[model samples]
Target: MAENVVIEINNLAKYFPITSGLFFKKKVAEVKAVDGVSFAIHRGETLGLVGESGCGKTTVGKCVLQLYRATSGEVIFEGKNLCDLNENQLRPLRRKLQVVFQDPYDSLNPRFTAADIIGEPLQINSDIRGSDFDRRIAELLDIVGLAPYMADRYPHEFSGGQRQRLGVARALALQPEFIVCDEPLSALDVSIQAQIINLLDDLQDKFGIAYLFISHDLSVVRHMSDRVGVMYLGKMMELSERDEIYKSPLHPYTQALLSAVPIPDPAVEEKRKVIVLKGEVPSPINPPSGCVFHPRCPKAFDDCSKLIPQLKDAGSGHEVACLLYKTSWP
Candidate 1:
């Protein structure tokens, strides 16, 4: 791992066992949620993971945070392999590694006030209590652009955007070095989404926090990410710098995904080609043989159905897992 890299996930895989039968509970199949996914998040940099729903984007985040223990592979954070750590050992490290879930309304406790929600982490991790804790909670509320007086109100009282702000405040309560923002803006209105995005940007700049931003919104991902990774059927199809991936996507899946993003200019939009993929995504329980994307890939050949293309560099920090780019690989 490089000194600048905050987290390195190498061949990270999470599989859920699918069982059948009532008495015996026989293992019938396994859902390969995240399989052989590899990437690194640099210090203070945002790495966007974009894919269609059920592509295992959220599963990757959960695996990194150890919410779901990975079936295999390593999640190395700050020179330490998190997979080896027990729950007791991992608990201490949780403060430095936080997460902001997609649904703010569902994630936050309705029974607790804003102050209680934000202060709960502080209470668990540290000895700060009484007026000190109150002051800290107040400061956090202010930091997230909420009034300090709003601390007394419950999560139900706040609007969708405000609830998200509170969630960000709680994540920031521990001053984490890395945060997994799992589609944080997906639930909010279009206008409110921008505000939350800007808020996250500002917070990242101020705190120098690294983010593994997972989303299906290509436009939003392109806007916030320093680097982007494209996933399909539990495999990473492409990875590259923000501009490189958007400008020249190497993989067929990546190209198709980028093509779907609506252009701002009417004239350009009219002229641009849309690469619509055929058929629905295959079930992860029994993915396609060899290259999982071969079924729908427009450029796939006979080799694609026989061999799984390794993700190799196509120069200039761009990586793609496709036979088309194999000649470029060193």
Candidate 2:
């Protein structure tokens, strides 16, 4: 991971309107997919975003890439605010920021050949043409450990892992400085997942690319990320260095989540007490007053239900949003 910052996301929020009626006219509520999330990714580093399903992990990635227009926030990439850029202004910057979606089967076009698929971005963003384009495509396939001959084949002819490799190849065509890996390994088999993860690490080392990796798997996040952020109900609950977050989790929610990860050693697993959460995640449409996790948090008290806990520094750059760590509550 490089020391220079590559992307900055500040107070980002994304909401989807829900309408239900005879005429489908009235806006009943808004799905608060992402709300007031802020983080920064440095060049050549991987920032893992982890949370349960529907916790807005993927939405943060899309909002950063400007794929989904944020309700409010600033996404500054390379010192420029991407939110203010129009379509034409964003076109050039698209090469700098790329995304790899989760579904290999759905993300790729069935009709397009692998060569065409990977070459599309290069063609749009760069002036490389004729033999140069063909050569570059071949090199990309080789870089991704795919045979150059496979380029002529369509997406359907490939297996799930192969299709994902193709997607990676496409994302790499631009030689992007940063990538939003939106659960890219979730669709692959366990064995294939290892291979893809190894490949991503190698590519990062070689190209010096930064990654905003979003996933629900804490173990995977631990392996790949330099820093990790835990989200719940569209709000960040914890943020810290990967090892610190795993080793000494300050928040009760963080401790509960880590306790659930199965230990390979039977003795350790038996000795551990899993802190099972008390309630289901609160609806983001109408989040609970005070801390959103108060309903599920074991350590929550009267003040937790009355005043929202601010994300404050616990120690060593670790931050947590919980009343237990606060001076008043403590």
Candidate 3:
């Protein structure tokens, strides 16, 4: 792991057991949600995770925050392995790691007032109460662009955007260093999504918060991420700097994904080739042999089906996993 790395995920793997049967006999079939993912998030950096649905993007984020217990590997945060930490040991570190879930409405408690919801974490972990808690809640609400008076309202009273703002406020209340933003804008209207993205950017600038922003929206990822990692079938197909990945994608999967992003200009849209991938993503329980992406990869050949490709730097900081860059040997 590199020095000054805020979060390091080494060979992280999270698998959900697929069980079938009635009462006594349950057979186990594993769903490899996140498999052997290794990456590090430097201090105060946003690493955008982009992929299609069920591509293990959310799983990776959840694992980083220790929400899902890793079957194997190390999640090192601030020089401590989160996987090894017991409940008591993880309690203190919880303040430094937080999450803004996908659905804001579902995430917030319907019964509790927004104030209580935001203050819940602080109350649970510390001796704060009464005036101090009230002040902190108010501050957090204001930070996320919510009015101080709106703290008394339930989640139902607020619009979708407002509910998301409350979620952001709750995440901020802990003054966390790293946050897993799991598709934070996916549920919002396009107009509101821009606002939330801007708010996140501003917050990062002001507080230097590191973010693991998981989303399927490539354009949004490009706007928000310093570097981006593309995942497919529980594996990383490509990882590179934001601009580099967008401008010159190396991997076939990455290229196809980028080509699908709608171009604003008519001329550019007309000129760009549409690289539609064939078939569907294979079941995680039974991924294809050699290269998992070979079935859908446009550039895939005989070698792709017989040999697994390693993620290697092609040029600059761009890393790709494909046989295109690999030399044929006798």
Candidate 4:
């Protein structure tokens, strides 16, 4: 791993067992939610993960945070392999890693006041209490653009955007080095989405926090990410710098995904070739042989159905997994 890398994932896999029986439930099959995914997040840089629902984007984030124990492979945080650590061993390191879930309404505890919600982490991780804790809560509220007076109110009192901002404040309360933002803006209004995105940018600039921003919105991902990784059927199809991936997508899946992002100009949108992918995503439990994306890929060749392609560098830090680019990668 690089010296500046905050998180490094190597061949990470998470499988959920499917069982069926009358009296004795035997393991029927395993759903390969995340299969052989690898990537690294550097300090202060945002890595955007974009994929359709059930593509295991959320599973990857949870695995990195150790919320879900990986079925195989390593999640290396800083220099330590998180998969090797037990719950007790991981407790101290929890403060360094955090997550902001997709639904702000569901994530925030209604029973607790805003001050208590943000202050809880501080209480658990440190000894700050009394006036110091209150001060810290007020500071966090200010950082997330919420008024200090709102601290005494409950989550129900705030609007959707304000609630999401409160969630951000709580995530930052512990001063984490890395955060997994799991579709943080998907639930908010279009107007509010920009505000949260800008707030995240400002927070990153001030705190030097690295983010694994997971979303299905390509436009938002392109704006916030320094680099982007595209996944399909639990496998990473491509990984490259944001502009590189957007401008010259190497994988068939990536190309199709980017083509679907609506152009701003009416003329440009009409002129552009829309690559509409046919067929539904394959079941993870019984994914197609060889390349998982072969079933729906318009450009898939004979080799795509017979041999699985390994992700390798195509050049200039662009990594792609596809038979077409096999010769380009060494």
Best by lDDT: 4
TM-score of 2: 0.96
Which pairs in model 2 have colliding backbones?
none
Off by over 4 Å in 3: 327-330
lDDT of 3: 0.89
* lDDT tens digits, residue span 199-302, model 4: 99999999999999999999999999999999999999899999999989999999999898898999989988889999999999999998899999999888
lDDT tens per residue, model 1, 1-330: 888898999999999999999999999899999999999998899999999999999999999999999999999986789999999989888899999989999999999999999999998998889999998998899888999989999999999999999999999998999999999999999999999999999999999999999999999999999999999989998999999999889898999998988999999889889999999999999899878999999988888888888888889789898888764222
RMSD per model, one decimal: 1.2, 2.0, 1.8, 1.3
- For model 1, the stretches where C-alpha displacement exceeds 4 angstroms are 327-330
Per-model CA lDDT versus the true structure: 0.93, 0.89, 0.89, 0.94
Better by TM-score, candidate 4 or 2: 4
Rank the candidate models, highest lDDT first. 4, 1, 2, 3
lDDT of 2 at 329: 41
Error of 1 at 284 (Å): 0.8
**TM-score for candidate 3, residues paired by index:** 0.96
